[model samples]
Target: MQESDGPAPTSFPRPPNLLDGSRTSLRQILWALVFALTLPAVLIATAGFRSGYRAERETSDRRLQETARALSLSLDREIEKNEMVLRVLALSPAIAQGDFAAFHRQAREVGLASQSRIALIDMDGRVLLNTRTTYGAPLPDNWRESVLRKMQETHKAQLSDLHADPITGQALITIDLPVVIDAKVAYILSAAIGPEIFQRIIADQRVDRDWNAAVLDRSGRIVARSRSPAEFIGQLANPNIRDASAMSPEGNVQSVTLDGISVRAYFSKSPAYGWTFVVSVPVTELAASFQRSLFWLFILVGCILLGVLLAAILSRLIAKPVDRLVAAAQALGTGREVTGTTTRVLEFDTIQKALADAASDIRAQERHREEALARIAESEARLRLALHACHLGSWEYTPSTGAFEASSQCRAHFGQGPDGPFCYDDLIAGIHPEDRARQAEAVAQALDIRSGLEVEFRVVQPDHGERWIRISGRVRSGTDGDLSLVGVSQDITEQRLADERQGLLLHELNHRVKNTLATVQSVATMTRRAAEQGDEGAWDAFMGRVQGLAKTHDLLTATQWQGASLEDVLRSELDPYQDAMRQRIRLRGPRVNLQPGAVLALGLAIHELATNATKYGSLTLPEGRVSVMWAVALSLSPPVLIVEWVESGGPPVTPPRRQGFGTRLIQRGLAQQLGGEIKLDFQPEGIRCVITFPVKAVLAEPAPAEDSAERYAS
Candidate 1:
């Protein structure tokens, strides 16, 4: 081996300074760039603005005019919808048969959501049935003489202007349709809608806050308004509104509003009726665009100053990130790992990560080389360490010289101290007397055939105890041309124990399956006899029994037959009728686990009890309730689990005239399988069942210390 030499030093190239003193300042460059880009745009916009002033005025007015047109169309559709509803109500068969009471109920349902009401008025303007009031109750005289005259003249659905309700005195718009009986107008069916319905429509259209929107009838009266609708409704609109609408039906004009403010008004008249929708804005808004060019001239000078200020701020921000980047580069050159840092700049972050990754890759390569050499030159101590890690013992023998070598683990496998001397005599003495002779024969046979040796045997440890061991070996030639046997041994005592337990479990499973099949056969025979004697429910009863047994078996299988929860057994039988609200049936108990046999018996009994309750006990009545409670009686000589079921608020209970299959199963099966006592009482109030079983026989977890053999046995 050669001695180490000191590390050599090397120099790296330095980067040239990019920020030289002779270069232009970044602030001057930024100002030049901004000035060049914005100069032409500023000039062009300023010249165009003065020439386009008149056009802008027309556009503003036209936009308002279009908004008014759209609002007018929306208002027309709402009135049309109300008219259709009124016409449908007029055609109802109930009204034609003089059954106004029935018609009123139908109208109330249609208008329930809108707060609108329907009224039947005769030709004499007398209010008949009104949905707003109960049938046969006194109604206000709300008939309008003008509305009736107009309806009689048209004989079709028509919309009325704003009117006050006689009872509530609130403004309402009436949609009226006449009922024609035998070629004569007999009655008017009117649906009264509040003015707020139209006000909502204007607000929904997103009219400007500074603007005013209104709906006007043929007389130019305001029916609805966007701003201050309650105060303006039913008042006459601006005088110019009627004059301009009469001439063009839709146009923009200048007028003074009721508040004495000068406004530019735009109106659209509905083609169906003479109703007009008017949208108005202040006159000053139209003239505000004339000074926009002057505003831009001032902005142009401020942008030049802002450009210089921003450039200085940005340069300071970039300087710190540049310093960090330089430090990272120097660290990489010095063969030290580069520490990661964030500057929140994309280009700088990418370069810093690249330098860090290069440093990491170099370190990984050197570490891999060192580890590979170490594994190649591993010594005997390393081999012993590996053997101990895997819980295996190493052994070697030279048949030609009768030499034996063993690792510390091999000494410990025989209950000897790890540092104790172990030879051929010690190895032979450790094997059980019964297995020593057979193991010797196996080794001799393998040597004669020049093959491998594999054998399992029991070893008697002086201090530890007896344990199972398995060894395997193959013959090889040593450096001296002598035959050597090298092998490894592992203690498999736990594996052997598991195999014995599996065998006993198989035997127990076989016995249990046979008993279950016998139970199934007995139930089937009983069900078939009943069916042949004309019992319609015999098959259902048999299936229910089989399903109940399957539920218990599933519960046991989930726990590998260790035990089943008693609450789970009860739920399986009563889950169909279970109520989380605890209104009808209630189950209360302490946590108790039951053995497989007890689980099956208790589950079946609960199933029968629940079925009987559903058919003839508390479950048959809405108010009936059943309470099932259970607890462990630890004070008894042998602790016992007691369960009780009581029913109340049900019909009187009576004992059966003859014993049924379910009754017999609950009475006999629970006692036989659980070795418990059961009492079933059928009192006048309800049926009550009590069950008692030894806790030691049924509990899965609270058992005394048991021998290993007994635990594994059936």
Candidate 2:
């Protein structure tokens, strides 16, 4: 221990006297610190209370405003959706052709889907057709007359105020769009929207239960209410909201609701119409929140007062014992044997006793440290046992002594006996000449950098012949300043063989990935070519082909990409139709295993055939039927497989003027992709397709395949 320039403590006092300097100093510091910390805390609490109350007010105002705006947006979107539908209906050819019957049917479908009623009116405000009734139905008098007058004045689109239907007394609103031809108003399209749609929107919003929300039309009538909707709907909104809406499009005001509840209400009026949506929260709730903030502040102030009282009482109790414990501790640090003394405190008295015997105990621990360390030698024996069990080896090399030591297992790795004199030279001799120099370089570099060594090399073992060996080791310094390398070694012959096979598999995988990407790119190009011709079904057709490819890939994956049977491929494309038609669609084929390439080509062909049948072939008629048949011609040398697709009982079939993408894929792409021939015939009765490919192209286990077949056959 080094001596300090400061004064040293002689001994621990029995107990610090009340008049002792340390006890007095500690007591004074505790009192001063308590007041110093408590004063600022009290000030901060007071400031925080004021700020928190203001924050709560602002947050409440923001929530009310945001909720009002959000509710208005929801109402606007519902109206906008129907308005868009109206615009689309205006473009209906039947409306331009003065075909009210056809337009009414189309409008009825739109109204059912859009949750509204469609009404068509002429320039004279006379009803033509209303989907709520039917084509040429009797019209009620003065139906939306004022609304139609306003819609004509604007000559654009209009949203009507909330009103009760005269016939049903249900609250309704209307989205009116004028159909203009040559800058002339030919007719007005009105979509009568019920209040239930708005009610659903308000119900779906995630608002607090304490908040009340309502949607109001231009007339200040309630179209939908978040609470008590059935009872309050179709009634006039609160007077405060109406007054505020008149003053400005949006604002906040304190008012009592229709139910006589005092609330802070925020209203937002729709920009398109004068309709307004209001969100309100009870004023009493704000008062309750303010009380909660005050309640917590009072609890914090009480805790501060209690802390001051505890400090005054505890300071005197612990100060003297703490002083004595510190003195005893300083004596132990000075390397002096302390004498036990009482402090009248349990922890302090125990500490004093422990300090008194600390010097003697330290000497005893130093003496036993070596004895504890000697037990580590047993670990080496255990490690040797472990290495033998794991078929691994351990070795140590000391360059200074030119000595090499290894476990019995390590000797066996190099084909040496356990008791054999296998020294440094013999170990070097066992390494294959080709890898010896590389392993030596690794060892040299590790030693120069003082880092770990990891080297793998081929070992020429006497018993096992050639074996791959991987050794991992690190440089270690001995207690006597000598250096040695200690590490473990294992045979990796099987791993080396597996790596070779994996390299070949990876090469093949890369080739397949490129081919698959090319196929996708080709499909996209063909689809774009079809789209350039204004084919509306281009996207659907493209997605269907891609999905067919994916499903075919799934089938290949199920069999580990070896092959899928011809029947399985056919069923994949036809099962959906077969499930619905017990006998109309039939399949007859042998278990001809088709490789991945064949499956892909055949899957696209079948999908195109099925799509055509559904659109124009036999499948379009209730009485029509389809037949798929295939057979393997084993009689032919290097045999071939043929598949036929026949359909009958459909409308008279005729050939198209020019081939489309689907037809081209069937006739040209299929033949090229499958290395085969295909034929398509459009007969008077139905369509017929014949597909033929070499049997080897579809063989599950072909005799060492040709260069092309091996690509997709895996």
lDDT of 2: 0.78
Once superposed on the true structure, which residue ranges of model 1 sit more than 4 Å away at CA?
1-391, 400-412, 416-419, 558-565, 581-585, 589-596, 620-624, 631-642, 649-657, 671-678, 683-685, 692-714
Which regions of candidate 2 deviate over 4 angstroms? 1-24, 111-115, 145-154, 206-209, 326-714
> Whose TM-score is greatest here?
2
Model 2 steric clash pairs: none
- Model 2 earns a TM-score of 0.48
Report the C-alpha displacement of residue 602, candidate 2, in angstroms: 36
User: What does candidate 1's lDDT look like per residue over 1-714, in tens digits?
Assistant: 998786876786643322223544434554566667567656766666655765786677778778888778777766655654564456466888999888877777553226688889899888898887898788766547887887778665777777777768888778788987754689988888887677888878887888788888888889888888778888999889878988988998899887787998999998666689998888887767766645755576467457657766776676667677766665665543335555444445445654765767788889989888777668666877788788998889887888988767777777778787788788888999999998999899888887898988988988648999888889888788888889988888999999999999999899889978987887788778778978798898888889988988888889888778777888777777756665577665556778877887788788888888888998898888887766564434466777878888789888889877787777667777678888777867788777888887788878432111011100
